[model samples]
Target: MMRALCLTGDPVADKLLTDDPFALLTGMLLDQQFAMELAFAGPQKIATRMDGFSITKIAESDIEEFVELCVTKPAIHRYGGSMGRRVHELALHVVENYDGDTEGIWTAGRPKPDGPEVLKRLKALPGFGEQKAKIFLALLGKQRGVQPKGWREAAGAYGDRGSRRSIADVIDAKTLVEVRAFKKAAKAAAKAG
Candidate 1:
């Protein structure tokens, strides 16, 4: 069994993330320009509104209707419409490439993929840039037990042990605060320089 994610304080949202690989990926895709916990909870909101979460359903959904779903009330992100489209595109990419097996990105192929290979696969996904790919790889290694050889190196700074640098290090409320602090400091330092 996969370990439960504590990204969102809400039990339902966190449970959805834990139970669904696609949901976890969606959350990571939504993590940009939004509060991390709320971003992670976006999948749960979609699951609730749509009656269940399915990557196929999301990919096949009418773009306008899907945008509406994302824009409804609380919304999936601050920029709901754009993020919704990105989510749709991500679903399509995964379906077309992995045949709906989200884990296949890491677990597929002869002799199994190593960390660099998995990172390359993640970088190919829609909305996953180099930094985002590295962070997700770190999350998989630290929490989801998707560690492949050289995972730590592929993940860069985010994979360092006990480092509260990104969502990968957030195991609880305390860690979330630590990550936020780290980001805030980094942003401040960048501005200062």
Candidate 2:
């Protein structure tokens, strides 16, 4: 069910995970304290802030004003009281520590430098937590092996009714069967050898 609803594969959303480092980081900053749909709005609001977010502009902006800008929508959908301020601080922190170079986040020596690493880095930012990091990574492609952890428990816990557990109860059931058969065959072949 998750795979089915996500069939077209969410490519545009996937790019947020690894392709464009700056945008991904920006989205992560905006993601804090909002729903999945709302958190994504942070990046969209930022494009007009400068000439394609040239980095210098964000670093130079009066974060207080930028935070006010972040208060407009998605970020404001939930506990939006101070979302603007949060976004402002996040951007400033990025610029201050990374020299506005968002991609430097991947140092090449840590934990395979994969999607999870990206999540780890983003989570390290202020205002970003586990859920924010996971949602941000979800936009990437679900490829980084990052998944919404509470989804299953939420379903059973609240009877979420939306759990699709009925449908996706066993993802790749056929594939699992095939894998088991392959393992059996390989084991037999090895024993015979």
Candidate 3:
């Protein structure tokens, strides 16, 4: 178990994330075009709206109704309709590919799991681009202690223990602020470049 996650300031929602692999995965998937805290809180909001957060349930839900659920008050994402579709697609992928075991995306495979393989799997998932895959790979190591061989190298700079560059390094409100500031600086640098 991940013990604790400070992603959302809400203890209950954060606890749900810690205890549920699917919630953690879904939260990571939602971490775009929205505030980090809101993105992390999304799975809980989805669980409340859907009465459960099962992968198969989400995968089988009606598309229009699921999109409506996402766009309802305290919507799941900024682009709720699209994000909801992505979430549903992600669930279906998990169910179809991993037998509903979200953890398999990171843990299953070769006897000695390699980080690049895990990264490849993450990148294959809906909403997981290269940066997102690396960030989540780093999160698995830095926070959840799910480090397979070569995880740090695979995660690149995001795997640096003390870096405040991404959610992988956020352990408290202070780290959250630091990460936000770091991201702001990086975005500014990109714009200038």
Question: Of the pair 1 and 2, which is ahead by lDDT?
Answer: 1
Q: Rate the local accuracy (lDDT) of all candidates.
A: 0.94, 0.48, 0.90
Error of 1 at 102 (Å): 0.3
lDDT per residue (tens digit) for residues 1-193 in model 1: 2478899889999988988899999999999989999999999999988989999999999999999999998999999999999999999999999999999999999989999999999999999999999999999999999899999999999999999999999889999999999999999999999
- The local distance difference test score of model 1 is 0.94
Output the TM-score of candidate 3. 0.97
- Residue 139 of model 1, lDDT score: 93
Candidate with the larger TM-score of 1 and 3 = 1
Error of 2 at 139 (Å): 5.6
For model 3, the stretches where C-alpha displacement exceeds 4 angstroms are: none
lDDT of 3 by residue, 88-127 (tens): 9999999999999999988786685689899999999988
RMSD of each: 1.0, 14.0, 1.2
TM-score of each: 0.98, 0.50, 0.97
Candidate 2 total steric clashes: 2
Q: RMSD, model 1, all Cα superposed?
A: 1.0
lDDT of 2: 0.48
Off by over 4 Å in 1: none
